[model samples]
Target: MNLLNMDAENRVVLNVGGIRHETYKATLKKIPATRLSRLTEALANYDPVLNEYFFDRHPGVFAQVLNYYRTGKLHYPTDVCGPLFEEELEFWGLDANQVEPCCWMTYTQGRGKFGRVSVTRRGAHVTATYGDMPGAHRFEWVNPNS
Candidate 1:
């Protein structure tokens, strides 16, 4: 095989929610025991015709997961709900504890609330609720410095 063809053979293509992401196979192998690293074992998700693996998951979140494989740092995506992100992490055999310290608070927000009064920051909306409350309250914070 030519140099370019040989190089392409070492890359992997992941189709997450119809979004295509390509990366080196060695990158996925960096994190042993993860779903990505074990892609060969999961024949059900592979598409031979397309030469890619399909995942019916959030594409935006999958970008972050792929990023974790490329870079050893895992940063929380603010656009995704905390619980949803945690679920994705679990499915990929990643530990939430590995989340960077800067994102820990946002990553854990609204987690373990169990109907207690808790505030969740999601983009422009801040949702707060009281235990067994009738209605949820939404508040937006304005930066004084800005």
Candidate 2:
């Protein structure tokens, strides 16, 4: 149904980056000034084949963003890269500060003539150490520019 005639309690189907999500219209309208809220308001009619509003976005990240709307809590997902997650949150008009501390960790091991470099993270902080050089280390985060 079109938004003009949609029921307040009706569930809306969203095909977000090929992933399907069914949420209450009221829930989707909870956050004003957000893309989701604007999308809900712009729902002129549902697609015939998909029968949902289609949006081009990373489906994986959208799941976490959806949860924020559903629960009023935001958790940085470990599966998604921090930089990418931050960009998605920005697009969704979400505050990055809502993220819980140390909610994610990433690891990268590099091996070469220099032996090996091990890197790990706790939230935005990253600690790196080299196997060849004793006590060799450095710390960094995803959003260095910001």
Candidate 3:
């Protein structure tokens, strides 16, 4: 069989921060020149006993990274801070600019000259608080359901 056919059948296990993930080798190959695609070159991260590669990285963010490989659509994970997500993307050799437009605002949120702004949604209202200082700016608006 050709290498492409063989790679499609090959499976790879990745343990990221104690989370185990299984994916086809061909999926990783979708994005060449990436850390996941060049796993064989990183012998130090391989675990022979479990037949899996181990990475001492954030598991939550890694999920999004792996999804990008599988779907070719990168998304921002809401649970992670923007800077942290950017850092994870850099480590995985993925471009942060590839984040989907739908998530771009959430991904770039809290990154401003003033400081971080925490936003919360309640029913039809959206509330945003900027910093925790004594007279911090707080805004609340009703989001009309279209």
Best candidate, TM-score: 1
Pick by lDDT: which candidate is best? 3
Candidates ranked, most accurate by TM-score first: 1, 3, 2
What are the clashing pairs of model 3? none
Superposed Cα deviation of residue 10, candidate 2 (Å): 1.7
**Root-mean-square deviation of each candidate, in angstroms?**
10.6, 11.2, 11.4
Full-model lDDT for every candidate = 0.82, 0.70, 0.86
8 Cα displacement, candidate 2 (Å) = 8.9
lDDT per residue as tens, model 1, 1-146 = 79999899999999999999999999999999998898893599998888999999889988989998898999899887677888889988998899988888877664543235667776665666654434555445644444
**Which pairs clash in model 1?**
none
- Candidates 2 and 3 compared: the better one by lDDT is 3
Error of 3 at 81 (Å): 0.7
Candidate 2: C-alpha lDDT: 0.70
Predicted structure 1: lDDT:
0.82
TM-score of each candidate structure, all chains considered together: 0.76, 0.59, 0.71
Candidate 1, residue 107: how far the Cα is off, in Å: 1.2
